[model samples]
Target: MRGALGVFIVRPNPDAGWSLSDADNGEVLVFESGGQAERLAMALARQAHATHGAGEVWVYDRLDRIVGRWRVAAVGMALADVDETAKAA
Candidate 1:
């Protein structure tokens, strides 16, 4: 069995955003920033990896054309990045 999580661009107009969806579910999430979409994709990818052992995450434009993708090979990168700050005062 194979599952895929996709992040698609929505509202091709000036207010363009991204949409996240799955082949198994109808639920969708829309975000105003690509970072948000990527974040969600990363989360989904990680979940899929842990649960299914294999899966795919994709990013598409408003035209439904694939623009980017992350598969099992890149699952490691799917994990969210941590931020660090230092005080020198």
Candidate 2:
């Protein structure tokens, strides 16, 4: 889970369910539902933040538009800051 500080994206798979990818490494994981993919992405982002002091998770809808974004700041800071702008996008 914890590896490097980077962005994680949860996006719909073209042929099926959902997928979570590490923006830094191109590693991908597939899940049956968006909720499942998002949850894992958030958990991984949190772990990365705890390990590296910063991390981010971006959730995209089926249309490939970013729908949600969560960012974790430096250690001891809030675990997540949900960006309202992403919802607006």
Candidate 3:
């Protein structure tokens, strides 16, 4: 909801696929497949970005391996990028 907000994808010990959560709250859904879970997370992140603000989403596999990080875009550049630009000015 604030700075460096994230929705993380994880695999709980008991589940066979992927799970989604906000960093504020851990492990929400124990989904059936990686593709399904990640797609849903992406949609959720985009919606949040649209309503709240820009943030990030990280995807992970069932083995707890990170897939990649996604930038949930609202309008301008990423916050870190903006900070870097200001520092250069």
Candidate 1, 1-89: lDDT as tens digits: 11333322222223567666665565567778777876776677667776767655655556645555555455274421112100100
What is the TM-score ranking, best to worst?
A: 2, 3, 1
Worst 10 residues of 2 by lDDT: 74-83
Cα lDDT tens digits, model 2, 20-46, are 999778899999998998788878877
Candidate lDDT scores, in order, read: 0.52, 0.75, 0.57
Q: Pick the candidate with the highest TM-score.
A: 2
Tens digit of per-residue lDDT, candidate 3, span 18-78: 6677765554777777677767777777777777675556654445554466667655323
In angstroms, how far off is 56's CA in candidate 3? Answer: 1.9
lDDT of 2 at 3: 45
Give the CA lDDT, 0 to 100, for residue 79 in model 1: 20
Q: Please tell me which model should have the higher lDDT, number 2 or number 3.
A: 2
Tell me each candidate's TM-score. 0.61, 0.75, 0.62
User: Candidate 1: where are CA atoms >4 Å away?
Assistant: 1-15, 74-89
| TM-score, structure 2 vs. true | 0.75
